[model samples]
Target: MRSRSTLPCCITLLAFALPAQVINKPAQPNKFLEAVGRRAALLGREDGNFEAWVYPIKILRDFQLSVYIDNALEPTPLSGLAETVEVRPGHVTITHVTAAFTVRQTWVASLDKPAVEVLLDIDTSKPLKFRVSFIPEMKPMWPASFGGQSTGWNQKDGVLTFTEGMGRFRPVLGSPRFTRISEQIGHQLPDRTVMIEFEIDRSGRVPIVIAGSRSTYNEIIQDPDALVPAADTFYREFLNRTTSVQAAGLNPSYDWAKIAIEKGWACNDGVGCGLVAGWAPSGLSERPGFGWYFGGDTMMSAWAMQDYGDFAGARAALEFLLDRQRADGKVMHEWTQSSALLDWPKYPYGYYHADTTPLFLFTAARYVRQSGDRDFLQKHWAKLEQAYRFCLTMLDDDGLLSNQKGGAAAVETGALSGKVARDIYLQGVWLGGLAGFADLAGWRGNASLQSEAESRLARAREAIKPWFIQDKGIFAFAQLKDGSRYEANSGWQGFLIANGGIDRALAEKAAASLALPTLATPWGTRMFATDSPFYDPVGYNDGSVWPFVTAQTTLALFRHGQAAAGYRYIYGMAQATGLSGAGFISEYFSGDRFAEGPRAVPHQLFSSVALVHPLISGMLGLDGDAMAGRLTIHPQIPCSLGPVRFERYRVGDAWVSGAIRPAKPTSTVDIEVQGPTLKVVKQPAPCIDLQEVKPLTPGQRGQ
Candidate 1:
């Protein structure tokens, strides 16, 4: 027998270098801003409110306000404030003077539309204050660089500051008596947009500060300690430079929320997934026949697009798989368009396994539902049919798919030789695929095909139940012919429930089993239980924590009325692995701890699968009742979040916007009819009685 230690190497090579820390440039001309503004204006009529900003770091700039007004009797004291001015480099400062106001100013630039940082040190205790206007020049810079690219401005402290190389700059205060009241807030506050009119006092000192504007704070505040030090450093440096002051009008029409979403999705790798985590250490190298197997790297990226309703992305991935399907109907284990061979040694005892086919089927079905594009389905149906036929071929006399050959044997173990085995994972995949096909058939209106699929699926489920049942509930994986049990209890089994292969009761049992400390890990779901005789924390499949499996399992539990448990599992993995902080999911983490491995693979596609599909199916509970031509949804949103909104989504034939609001202990479910005039039902049952709608014409046949 091959020792578990000798697993095949599965590596990844990122196309780009890791992002570097950004160095802020000292006060300088805002060329990038000017360029962006120019571009925006050219694209549309100059609405004056059109604003452009850049961030080398993640920070919320449009939050909070401090306004200073000249209280002089002369009405012109605030005059000419609308003119654009620039702050001299290393000459701006801000100092807190009293609870009511702070001192801030900079040297005015002499040119037209000069870049300037407007400072509003508001007196929280005052009632109403001044009116001032000017083109506010705000520059925010990140502390990191993209390779060796120039560090751009990003929001640092509450105030937007521009950095130049090693120099730090901010609005400076000339007087020492100014008392700066640091908003002792823990997390970075969100940006808000407000419109306020102020009164100038006789002494030229503005007395009141009114909340005026609002906008979204794109910066995500995770760790207070980690962010505060950097903020303080920037603030202190800004206080050292002082000169003049100015005020700018608020831009009300800009939409920051959309910008944030776009930015969040920008990190995606063009190959169908996002790299939420950093690149894998192995570097980019193609498998002998497979184009690229980033392991869980590409897999985890699937979720980043889910919340955004990126059906195009989902379809691209399905098409990739469909195009790569083999003549035998079996999808390649893993391949890139550049390569013809499949890579399967990554998972031992599963060479050209039956599991891959089912995964492909599931993804394809999802694509068809989201797009409602019959052309794509018709084009890929042959591949789909072939794959299903191949799966049928794998079914043993007992009606369960069995693995007749184990994966490549490690060189130390000589040649490979072992009795054929049956993996529970394969069975789960088979069921998932069957269910997916049934869904597709219903969508295509093929009543006969749908019925045939449903029958086959029922038989498949019945054949596996006896061998899977155990005193504890369901066996994780079973033997090929006899009812021998495989000791490996993994989160993958939980996916069967999440994927809708099994009922809620069995899913709950599987989820409960996942809580075992032996199988649980800080990073995510461990591949196998540590207490198992074959367990090895460092072994590839023996004890590794695979994020992809964890995501799938979590989704399953959430769908089965175990939302809290599912959220806990997902949140724990995100926090422990620092994946949430990084704003991305990784392929896998160390089994013993959450530290990322040197061979850490990034941009995994399946890892994000949990992020997207589950939110729709589990959280929102959106599904098609084919026969009724209706859409159903049961939303169970968490308490802390505000109304969950989806911008543009396709349900049947119409596009619609919808929100999910939680109702105390019970979740609120709502579905809006957007497509053709169709039935809308409130019940939470599947459309089992609906007959599949058939194609209207010969061209639509099989589509």
Candidate 2:
């Protein structure tokens, strides 16, 4: 009944009296995070350090945008006190005033190229010595120097070049004549600093281009604005390909959704192009020196892209994996960009994760429903069959999918650390895959195959119930090889069952348990409960919160008659979307403070799509089955949202969009079909009897 920030009556009563001035004001609403350039994928700090990578290539490490005022040769990094504001797209003005002089630095990044532009505007009575520099980490790019090697760089032909065996980047300098030049070579930013001094000219505007490829370099040399359309063209292609959401002014989830999807896209120019897990083209990993392409990440994003009506993006991402599907139907976990290192011809696949295969099937079935791409379906049916067959092979003796024997799971850390046993979550996923596969078989008129998949689903449901749900608990996170249970708070629990099409008991139980703080955070759900022994808020899987997981759980909640709780998770995700990166939803947040953790990827697809998925499938509850030639709508909207609209949302060959709002005593949904209206099913929420249900912990049941 109150605002998101309102304190409970119990908490406010205990607050110590304070001066009127000490009272807190409603926090400033966080604005949308926008790209510096229309399609630029660069982020920075107050310090001069800038991270950039030419898409499809790895991160260009050690390069920075540094400025020196009044010949001091160094300027303090923007203190936390300094207010850095985006003055315009691709430009921000940073004014760090101190006793010495007040300096205004305008930072800019070219919308199309991997470049940073800056001009240090000074206001001082005395002769001011100002310099802007491009610093590079001294080590060569190739044979990556996790060794921390050092090398000095030089300028020739008006271009500053940094090269290593891996690749090369050249900065095309503009306008400013360097009065001084110097370089420091090593691992740290200071060690690799490059000082480029310039005289104060009539127009202080300076332009420099960081050329990633020979074509980009040549285009810039011929016409500095030549590559501008690259970004504009890319934006144009995806801008209209959208499914957006907004709760009036309350949330900016829709504002950041498109950006997050865009961030996940990268092209190699030739190998194959599709939506990636994250655009981690540059920047060393926490371990350093290696980069990878993730299959699980891609699969999750496929549904996200599909939700946005970008069937092409969704299809491309899925097809990319299907192309490399193992002979036995095992989808890969991850792969490197430079496949030469992995012997692509003989060993193109890297299968490790058990969920990827079943997930691939799940997504494949979804694509078929949304696209009615029977041609694509017929082509990949064998591979889909192989995927199903493979899932069966990996069914552990416990009648569940085991990550220890198959692949690294979504949970990468914790107390139930490692063993090749069934995780409660995988059973749900494998179940969903079986059901979906069976449905696909039925559509194809293959009774035998359909029956086979249906039988597997039947077996999975019976076996999974006892393994995961016990002691009147909603769900168990996982089972050890020796049959011991780790009844921890796992955010993925709802998703596992949701995907498997399981019953309402687990759903209702999860909802009741999560109403408290065990799994729920003000931001979203935690990977593991902070109170659990496996809890490590900052640990990758120990206790980090994942937006994508929250999105999946939100959908599960809505379907199982927990729409009230489901909406909270959805809104929490939307609120946290732009917190760290403005418009970008990051990879994961630390479990403790719900803050961004180390190596969290910004504009990550799954995270962005996580919000998108819940809004589409849960709130709108639109189901398009091209094969069945039917559109289903089961809307459950909270009255507080006022009125909501889903514009131009596509389902298979037919296009439909509509609006829904609270009616006299309930909610009413209206649909607009672009083409001839076909069979439409408007379903209502099922009755949920709460007469005997009582509050309970995640690990227990109560009446």
Candidate 3:
């Protein structure tokens, strides 16, 4: 650790680094209205089921939010007859005009409560009856019961409640008498159809409320009287959380990433708050995969949240994970929700991952880098010190992290599980942790630690190539513990590439080998080649396509000067978020070499991280050394997307924003930075309106 006498210097560095210790701008209400989707529409609220998906393109199997008209037997096919499906950040509007009656329905979900509000306007000549239904696939643990029949409520209560295990779903209306029970016989499907009859009485408006509850069962939650106001307040407060960032020259990946981050953002009663990887619907009970708080997820989410100016969420997630670190500096994988601890006996496994601890260090370093919050560093320096020490112990004489060798600790799934060698993925992370430690050490002026970390990083870099790089244009997954090797094209290449400072020819060959059509998907890179004997499209790790890996590779591509290729991967990741209309990236996709995946959670935090990172690190190329009061921007504009602007982007205590307009036929970029105190340390691109940054006054505005 650095000497305590240098504390004042650290404080001075931070004092010049940030505008204020805490941002105190009075946040006025934000009227957020962004329409983003392809086949399905994502309704985002900090409340509700954390997601409400509507399939407007093809309503054959719309997941959560569904609509039915008149005949329950022949339900209305919304996609086939739908005219318009308009989405705003606040609500979703779907209008369908048929030969008989014209139905216009608006779906508004509360951002503050566990409820959805729907307003329907019908225009018909004859008496028409239609029903609106909400069917969620609450898989597993459901030899269940449905209908408005809870402990005290009945069908006469004009509500629909489906309760099983510890969870409940209630869809209520004030003036309707609803009674329907279509329970799943084998619990294979959530076929419990809860519908309220809407008899078209001379084209009038009808309101409906769909409330979903798991642990929240208070008077306000149970009361039908408060649903409307709850929704109204929710929309107002929730809009403030939504931000609009035009990707400029890029595709909708930036927008989708931001949306997905919001979708997967979760908070549980016991575990406090963190980003869940994804919530996949299965035949088994709803399991929050590393949900309560996964160290990896928390670490990765910091990238996305920071890129999108959601530092509060990022900080919350970071603190949540840090609070649960084990004594010996091992960061546990997850701290599950109270429900997981209560409802299931097999969950809350703290250290299922060997990569998580290093990843935690990576995230913390990045947070400090972006936030310039040396104050945070000062507070957590000892924890960081202990973590690095633990890492040193984990390293073998060969410098590889050996704890994950031939165990369930690292690479826990697919064919890689229980392998007899250390995988390259661990090395990639080990390298990242080394880089982070060196950077932090340099910041604190710890000469001995900085020299040691640099030396370790250099030795490992030289050592890995000889052991892992094979002659067949590939990097071996690992050198087996038995002195053999596992030769394969692993997605770990991205991590190695992104860590930078690798041999150019070796890194280039490794990157090109993985880009083969057999292993690359437009959505994400496959974990293994399709021709591999162990390849399974849906295999946990063998052939699965992970969007986060795609993102990591995208950053690596940028580091290797393949910015255009990196942009394509960004497009693929953005498209994956639209698959379920949940605006969340799933855990992994079937490695059929497509961008989309099935059989995974819908909203992996790193999936969003995949997007958040590239926009800043790749495209805009903004690097901030808050400690040195230096900022740099390099333009990596692709020819296809044209010039773009990233407005109102935050950099530590200040906001440095500009547009990337093409300098015409020359293929150069005309970059411009508006007035700000951020001093230029390295700027290759031509910039306009650069200004000298002064220390921020007491009430300067920067959120």
Q: Per-model C-alpha lDDT, please? A: 0.40, 0.59, 0.55
lDDT at position 651, candidate 3: 62
lDDT of 1 by residue, 1-703 (tens): 1101111133221222111222122221211111111001000001111122221121112122234434544323221221222211212222323444433322111111112122333334444343332222222211122221111212222222223333432221111112232222222221232222344332222211111011111121122122223433432332211100010110000011111112222110122322222222111121111114321222233233333345555455455555555667766544332121124334332225456676666666755665566776777677777777777777777666666631211111211124326766667767877888888777667788779878988888877666545575555554634555665576657656666466556667777777666776534567667666566555665666666677776676666655655544544443432132122244556676654433444323344444444545555555643335565666555565434544234443544434455555454434444446545544332211112222122112110
Best by lDDT: 2
Ranking by TM-score: 2, 3, 1
RMSD to the hidden true structure, all candidates: 20.7, 9.0, 11.3
RMSD of 3: 11.3
Give per-residue lDDT, candidate 3, residue 610.
82
- What is the alpha-carbon lDDT for the whole of candidate 3? 0.55
After the best TM-score superposition of candidate 2, give how far the Cα of residue 91 lies from its true spot, in angstroms. 7.5
Give the winner by TM-score.
2
Candidate 2 vs 3: which has more TM-score:
2
lDDT by residue (tens digit), candidate 2, 188-267: 33444465655543433344444454455455555544343454455444544465443554234554565566555444
